[model samples]
Target: MALYNAAALIPSGLLSVVFSLASIFNALNARVFFGEKIAVRVVLAGLLGVSGLILLLWDSLTVSFDPDTVRGIGWALLGTMIFSWGNIASRRNSATRTAPIIANAWGMGIGAGVLLVLALATRQPLVVPTDPTYLAALLYLAVFASVIGFTTYLMLVSQIGSAQAGYATVVFPVVALVISTFFEGYAWTATAVIGIALTLLGDAVMFGRFGRKRAGKILKLT
Candidate 1:
C-alpha cells in the first residue's frame, strides 16, 4: 500500500495503467505459491482484461515520456508485485483460519507502524489536517476502502482461489472511469467504449456467466 501510494506521486496516467498488472502477478503467485491450478478460462479472462486495460489507457500512455515518468512506472510495477504478495499472504492466512477482519486489523496496524517510523526517520511533519473535506476523505478511506473493501476482498480470496479474486484489480479501473466521467468530466471515446466492453466480457467469462453449456463446449474444443 505504501508502494502504491508512492507510485501515485507520478504524473503519468501510464502509471495507473501499469498498476493494473497486479492482477496478473496475483494469479501467477497463486499458482507458484499456493499451487493453485489456473483454469484455461481464467487465463483467457485475464488476457482479455489486460488487453482492455491497455486499450483504455493507450491514449494517455502515448504522451511524451521523461526520466521521472519511467522511474514512476518502475515504482508502480514494484508496488504491483508487492501487492500480489499481499494477496497471497491474505489467502494463506485465511486458509489457516485467521478471520479476514482480524488479519486486516493486524496487517493495517503493522503497516501503519512501519509508515510512521519511516515518516519520523524522514523528518516529515505529522500534523493533522484541519480541512473538513480532507478529514472526511480520510474517514471515507479508512472505513470504506481500508476496512470494508479489504475485508470483502479477503473474504473473496478465501471463498474463491486467489487467481479469480485478483480480477478485482482489473475491474477497479472500469469503476474509476465511470466515476471520472461524472465527477472529473472525463470524455468517453471510442477506444474507451470498446475497452469497457472487453473488460465486462472478461469479467463475465471469469465468473462462468457464459452458461455451463457454452463453457463445456469451449472446454471440449480446448
Candidate 2:
C-alpha cells in the first residue's frame, strides 16, 4: 500500500505497464507455490493482455529520465510484486477454509492500524472532508471499491486460483473507459477500440472459449 501510494506520484504511463506485469508475477508465483502447470494458452493470453494495456496507454507512454520518475517506477514494480504476493496469500487462505470477509476484515484492519501509527509518528494531519461531493466519493469507494470489490475478487481467487483472477487488473481499464464515456464524456479513438478488442480477445483466450475439444486438448498438454 505504501508502494502504491509512492507510485501514484510518478507522472507517466509506466505505472500502468508495471501494474499489468503483476499478472505475470501472479501467474509465476501460483505455479511456484501451488505446483500449477503453465499452459501455452495462458502465456499467450498474458502477452496479449500486456500488449493491449500498452496500446491502451500508448499516448501517455513518454520517456522521462528524471531520477524521481525512475524511482517511482521502481516503487511501482515493487508494489506490483507485493500485490501479487497478496493475491497468492489470499488464495492460500481461501484454500484453508478461511472466509473471504473475515480475511479481508483482518487484512484491512491491520493495514489501517499501521497507517494510523505511521500518520501519528510522522505527525501528519488527519483531515475529514466535510464537502458533500467528497463525502459521496468516499462513500462510493468504501462500499463499492473496497467492500464489494475485495469480496468479489477474493471469491474469484478461491474459485479460479490467482493467475486467472489476476486478469481482473488487465480488464479494469477497459471497463473504466466504458464507464468514462458515459460519465466523463471520454472520446474513444481507433487505437482504443483496437485495444478493447485485443483485451477481450485475450480474456477469451485465457478462458479457453475457442472450442471445448481444443481447450481440453490444450489442458491435457499442460
Candidate 3:
C-alpha cells in the first residue's frame, strides 16, 4: 500500500531513497528493543549509505511540497518503519528457534491471503499478468526476493543483529544498478562511481567485525 501510493506520486528512485531509512530505523529499533549497543561504525556506515544512494540516483531525485508528494513520503516512511520492525521481529523469531524457512513460508502465505482479502474487499479485479517480462519479474521477486532473500536475511539477522542485517536493504540498489549496467547499458557518471564506492565501504565497515564474529561462533558451534 505504501509503496503503491509512493509509486503513483513519486519517482521510483525517490521512493527507494525514502525506503533506505530502514537501515537507521533498524539500528534504532535494535538499541531500543534488544538493548544492543549502537556502534559508531554503524552510524558512519549509514551516513555513507544515504549519501551514496542520493548521489547514485541524483538524476532521479526530486523535491516537491505538493500534497501528494507529502502523502507519498509519509507512506514510504511508514513502510520503512514497518520493515525495520519486521527485522527485529525476525531476529526475535530466530532467537526463539523459529527457522527462517518456516518464518518466510508462513509470512508469504499469510501476506498473500491478506492481499487477496484486501483486493476482494476493495473490489479490485483480479488480473493475470500476460507480459512475459512482467511474469519473469514476478517469478524473480517471489522466489529470489521473497523466499531466498528473506531466508538469507533472517539468517544474517540471527548471526549478526537486525541492525547490521538491515544494510542489505541499503545495498540492494547497487546490485540493481550493476545488473542495469550489464543488461540495460546503464550510463555511469562520476557521482555514480563514487556513490557505489561509498556504499560498499559502508557495508564493509558495518559487516567486517560482525562477520568475523559470526564465523567464530560457527566454529565454536561446530
Ranking by TM-score: 2, 3, 1
* Tens-digit lDDT string for candidate 2 (73-170): 78888888888898999998987999998888888898889999999999999999799999999999888998888888989989987878888878
Task: Summing lDDT over every window of 10 consecutive residues in candidate 1, give the lowest-scoring window.
Answer: 2-11
Clash-forming residue pairs, model 3: none
Candidate 3 residue 80 C-alpha distance from true site, Å: 0.9
Cα displacement (angstroms), candidate 2, residue 64, comes to: 1.6
Model 2's alpha-carbon lDDT is 0.79
Stretches of candidate 2 exceeding 4 Å from the true structure: 211-222
Give the lDDT of residue 7 in candidate 1: 58
Relative to the true structure, how large is the alpha-carbon lDDT of every model?
0.79, 0.79, 0.83
- C-alpha TM-scores of all predictions: 0.87, 0.88, 0.88
Give the per-residue lDDT digits (tens) of candidate 3, residues 1-222: 667878898888888788876778888999999898666667677877878888998998867779988888888998888888888889889889999999888888888999999999999999998999999999999989889988988888889787777777777888899999999999999998998888887877677876445445655675
How many collisions per candidate? 0, 0, 0
Residue-wise lDDT of candidate 1 within 38-84, one digit each (tens)?
Answer: 56677777778878877887676665467766667677888888878
> Model 3 off-target regions past 4 Å?
209-222
